[model samples]
Target: MDKQTILDVLNNLEVVDQQGGDEAWMLVDVTPEMIEELDHVGVEKETVLKYGDDESVCILALAFGEKYANFWHKGQLVNWPQEAVDLIEEMESALRS
Candidate 1:
């Protein structure tokens, strides 16, 4: 998705991280479907949710990480992998609501 599309998907959230980045930030609790979707991208273990625009590290959008690293679900962050990226269209749907 394009930048604006991503913003819209995020409910037009303007949250920033500690570094004041424009991307929305949140700690998410993973669902079973999230794990399954992530698995399709070969993410079997825990990983980091590096922003697609983080230049200090390899930007996800520059690679396939964008598809797998997108996290938008809001939860208690329980029953989920730590320091991992979550990619599931279901997440976006949950967030939109």
Candidate 2:
């Protein structure tokens, strides 16, 4: 997806858990609607639908979320390319601007 769209998604991410820390929070499971929206905004259809008919395609998008991408990959939830990670990092940096 484009920078703004990714940023928008990150900005409005749904909270799932407290992550057992005072300030750590994890994003909620990504719903089909979220997948559809991301797909509409440039995320590949195959990428979003890869989870089959799963009701929630989970993602972690808070700070340090990039490093956790590997976990998603291991779970077969995502296969993020370096380019995608770069885009996400860029979007994350933009938060400081």
Candidate 3:
């Protein structure tokens, strides 16, 4: 989806910290500028996992230490599986509908 479409999807989401873990659900508000940044970086919204609430701008799962390095080495971020991204996108699509 395009930037505007992603923004619309994000606006309708709700942030929640499932399991009360360190994971945070951030529904980062996407501005035109933010969209430009993501586009510049070649990171698609569908590639990211949604975290917290609709009011949040972006959700991030963080892991610190050697494990983090290992995760990065494996092309994953904070243990976020590829399936999670797919799930988030599906939920976002449903929310929009």
Candidate achieving the largest TM-score: 2
lDDT of 3: 0.39
lDDT of 1 by residue, 1-97 (tens): 2433332323322223323146523422344544354444454424323432211222223122544334434521112243443445456568999
Number of the predicted model whose lDDT against the real structure is largest? 2
Q: Which of candidates 1 and 2 reaches a greater TM-score?
A: 2
Q: What TM-score would you give candidate 1 relative to the actual structure?
A: 0.25
- Give me the runs in candidate 1 sitting further than 4 Å from their true place: 1-24, 48-97
The local distance difference test score of each candidate is: 0.35, 0.48, 0.39
Total clashes, candidate 3?
15
Clashing residue pairs in candidate 1 (N, C-alpha, C atoms within 3 angstroms): 47-83, 47-84
Q: In candidate 2, what are the lDDT values of residues 1-97, reduced to their tens digit?
A: 4544554554455655435334533445667666666667666545544433354433443213433233222222343577886786687799989
Q: What C-alpha RMSD separates each model from the true structure?
A: 14.2, 10.1, 14.7
Q: Which TM-score value belongs to model 2?
A: 0.40
TM-score of 3: 0.29
| Candidate 1 Cα RMSD (Å) | 14.2
Worst 10 residues of 1 by lDDT: 53-62
Tens-digit lDDT track for model 3 on 1-97? 2433333333334444233235523334545555465545444444442322223344333122212211222222334466775677687799999
Preferred candidate (TM-score higher): 2 or 3: 2
